[model samples]
Target: MKKIGIGICIGIMCFSSFFSYGNEQVLPHHHQIQKGSASYIETINQEKNRYVNYGDGYMIDYPSHMEVDTSLEAVRTLIKDQEREIEIYYDNFHNTPNSAPAYKNYSNAFIKNTKDHIKEYENTATINGMKVHLLKWSRKKLSKVSNDKNFYVSAEIVKNDKEVYTIFIKSSRQFYNFEDYMDVISSFKIIEKKGNPSINTKFKPVERKLNEETKEFYYKYFVNSDKLRWGIFEQSAPASFSYLKGIENRLDYEFKFLVRYQSLDVPMPLEELKNAYNNNRYVELTLQTMHMNEENESITYDILDGKYDDYFEEYAKKIKEFNHPILFRLNNEMNGDWCVYSSYYSSKDTNLYKEVWKYIYHVFEKNGVDNVLWVWNPHDLSFPNFKWNHYLTYYPGDEYVDIIGLTGYNTGNYYPGEIWRSFEEVYPHVYNEYMDIFEQPFMITEFGSNEIGGDKVKWIHEMFDYMYMHPFKNIKVAIWWNGIDWDPLRNPARIYRLDNREDVMDTFRQRLKDYK
Candidate 1:
């Protein structure tokens, strides 16, 4: 019966793509480019939506409000799980006229850089807009023999004089034609923002607090504080600067200062890390301690081995050198039987994990890593109290800790959206209680969605929406665990392949620039 049901699901999903890919284009008059930089003209005449405009193009419109970037040189918009991006580059043939042949030649090069899943798919009339040369293709097919394979993908490409664009949409093979029903793809348009854009217009930030009564999500209130609220979000280049401006407008506050992680490659000795923090580049130093001890060994033996202490001494010197606040999270998410640290410290042995936690904290203090702030982070549970005791069972002394953190990820067999919804239902207010007891800043140290669907763009938006509305006032930093072996469902060693998805990376990076 289960096998039959799974087969039926696969069949139905095959038709899912048409809904996102088969629509005609639509261009609004508001999106018209002002006659400047280059000649500008537009025409829109489709029953549903189809429009075309040409000039010094600056902005692009999408059929849906997706995670989008509308910078001038490059434009990208995500529709469901599909991503369409156009990057403009100068073509210097001097007098070489702009033609489809030249465009196809360049397109072929772009296609070559990608996997064989994409082939020259099709060329068709673009909704109500000018004719566009379109090519469609798919990624390597799924195999019945192995669990390791790149997630399936399909793509659409379009080219013109100013830029050459490609749309790479990813999904399981079950939803191969995902773009077929998407309204944005067939009916998208680009236009330029008008007027000499002003130089420095500082923004007023909007604040929001969690509204329990609503039950649903909202982002229009904040905990008013005498001291200005502080936050951290990363940025890239030109677009990143624009995103920063947008954040400033929404928050009405300049960052107190910036703290960049000096290095993520090799483990820093406690001494060197402290020095960097003391210099004031950033206050908090996050220590990853899972690899510091041996897994599957007696708790006493592990501690007496004195491995963790060696690293603590090295790390302490660095923390004291900078006089920086340290966010020390050791053996995070140990309730789950995944890592050597966590698996050995499961719910049954409360004393074991706690004793180890204390030993490390004591070593740090004794070695002068006192300037550091400690955080106790754990995984979210489906059955609230079933494993509730595991959360505080091994909690170390009050003198040794400052913050509590939680790691959450969506883990369903299929449907990323549904998986995310399940997580919210499983552990709704656990963090509020964590803060109440600890009375220190808390954080979602690691959070991400990894079920089955390909809608990474939507996943990011929903996550930010939740972060913007957590009830706890101290729920401060929310870092997406970008570490390679963090996925709970798959083999940890192979998780590195998942990070290769360029679309996922872009969406994640954009959130960092926007939310803080």
Candidate 2:
């Protein structure tokens, strides 16, 4: 039996060597040989036979069967790409069915410390009569142009104790049929060899590193201010104040301003908006809500034409007269595509959008409007793209903008603790990037989570907890999306009136105390 086995092995070696040379006959057309040819395969097989000298290890089995070229470079490249997907998978695994709080904390830390992109990884596994090792993972490209671009990764893990086989597959798609593949993956069984066992290592918790620039920003906005700490907004000024008075003991909240987005000709003209904002009653005021510009399209730039130009001038004059910190958010959420102003104005055409914002700022300056902190509020559409462009489209330059504000209200729409899909993710990344670019203060110009099961209190507390930790700098104000209509666009705002529900009062008071 031993002699027969030896003969068979020799025959296999000769057969492999015979075809491994420069033999185009064996090469497949349309498939260029990277490195592994017949000869290379023979050499690798030879190496495998001398397993007594090399160490053996174990890992999960490859779920699929595909040609795995034995080229070192190809294998290395494949392994380099899969590192992130693998890490994320592992994180999810450990976090779930484990400890939620610990997972959250650890995940945050891991995200902070992750510096390099995936380069490579290797692990061994054994299946039926074979030895498998997860040998490679690599990062193919950066997510620059396409968010949908697959994060390319490759895996070559051996399965079964007898086969000495490997499989390569995409990390993103590999785990889809997780249960079906689990049996194969679990078949990995490592064999002991002569080499000493290397140090056993596992993924560690990552530390959240605060950017130096961002740290300096917080110092300027939150810590530096004594009286003018936080800008507060509400639908009903009187009602909001009663809630404000309740929280006044704990927080130095600023009643920024209270005004409606309607025709400038109503009640007392645009000047009343400025006076209400400046009297120290509030620090910011959104002025004359002009008709949504559908024809020209760009929301920020679609001025109320020459007819309302005088009213706008008069509004500027009032701001100049009072000389108080008032935030002027002209046309907001223009990037949403739903709002008429955003639909028409948000365009790549430079003059198209800039011209409008420029006109507004230029007129305000011409009217000698100072003490007015111009806030450019963009709905947090999404990160890297949506909000960034829309918010910045009609920036009106540095001279005009004092604060960069983002509006994000929690509708009873989304699940609590669930990471928001579009705007939620956009908020952090956008805040970081914008601050890096503009170095100006950022605000949640408007943000509030609606009630679920009449649990608005819990919702508010949770949202506030998130902010208390990762506070945006230069955010002198935050307006709740609470109002009677509850329409996010028209009258989004918090019901902070003294006569309002005591629970509302309690929530505000607690948040103020926590902020302090």
Candidate 3:
């Protein structure tokens, strides 16, 4: 999933190539320019969201739930699943007497991009004060596999000024409310803002808390505190305690938490939780909605429809009875295509992802499960990193999440395309981004260096040094994944164990002894 996510995000995401407005790298009123930046749209108080693209210098009240796609050179596509999309094109908006109006090219760009369509309705009218060329069309034969004559609506309004824009949106199944498209067209605006654009940092976390004593204790001692807890996940979760016990004995160093990965195909990790809590350690559950052995199945839709309500309800009851602060990380690394819950499988509809999260969160809340600190996690990078599939798009919001969990790994050269990553390379880039925007505490939910990559010893030693650096903020816990990711063909593909060598254990022992 890490490799898949990295490939998609890095290859598909780019913010530049939109039109410029004013003299100071601003957007023109209706002109086209193919050189600008991108600030993808998202997040709000769950209201009718007005997204402000600080990078492109535009503000529009787009439905917050919808996804944005800016992978195109000078186009911003607002999409609602596979069927509906709004393409906003920005081209060179300057005009010369010797040639056609630059804004006139907005219509041409639209025609150049869209193909194989039959026009249903073509007319001209002023819907939102701006005269628009209205068009409604459809493609009867979608493809060889499916003849989904999915409906399409389109229009073009080019002006003498640089204010030219192609208008189009995908409608639902066979029909759509025309007013919806009109409203979207009217909402477009190009303006100026002062500072550089950033991920929304003005966000305020929802006021959710646990029992008074525990809540206060956690906030004071753990969340955002100077204390850093070392965590681990062994090869087999059930035998993890026995394996971890050996490590604890070797260096007289105890891990504060244990991490486990489980899919919803089985029961919750009651025994694992018991093992950790009994031993005075916390447990981080990397919960997933897919079948553990079968990666193809995704039950996110079923989960939303309440098919698994009883399952979660039972777990909620158990968790509350357990009465410990469980780091409940539901569906970690969601932005990766290798994850069943990613939008890649859902027609790029991330709303379903966010919906399942809120549904799960609400179920736990209804059962009064206060001991669970909801951990919303994403891969350090996004798969397809298209604006629609970005990690931020999957965030369930402040009220629903308590901790912002992060995951990255150095897989070494075990896989065909995998590469070794230094601690500095894997962490600081994402850390800096999260530090600016998130209010919740951070955790390296899962990470490790594969012995196949570079110097595993040096990686471990350098990891300790990096962790001790004071420049980082709000990072409370870091967990090492101490297991082998075996390839069917290459059996021992990647080894991440810290106790594989006395020298390696010595490295951790020496560094940890002086940590405090």
Please tell me which predicted candidate would have the highest TM-score against the true structure.
3
| Shift of residue 516 alpha carbon in model 2, Å | 4.8
Q: How close is candidate 1 to the true structure, as a TM-score?
A: 0.41
**Cα deviation of 440 in candidate 3 (Å)?**
1.0
> Which candidate achieves the best lDDT against the true structure?
3
Clashes in each model (backbone N, CA, C under 3 Å)?
A: 49, 57, 20
What's model 3's TM-score? 0.68
Writing each residue's lDDT as its tens digit, candidate 3 over 157-195 gives 544254444544655466556665666666666556444
lDDT value, candidate 1, whole model: 0.39
TM-scores vs. true structure, each candidate: 0.41, 0.46, 0.68
> What C-alpha RMSD separates each model from the true structure?
23.3, 18.9, 11.9
Q: What is the C-alpha lDDT of each candidate?
A: 0.39, 0.40, 0.63
Question: Where does model 3 exceed 4 Å of error?
Answer: 1-174, 177-197, 236-240, 295-298
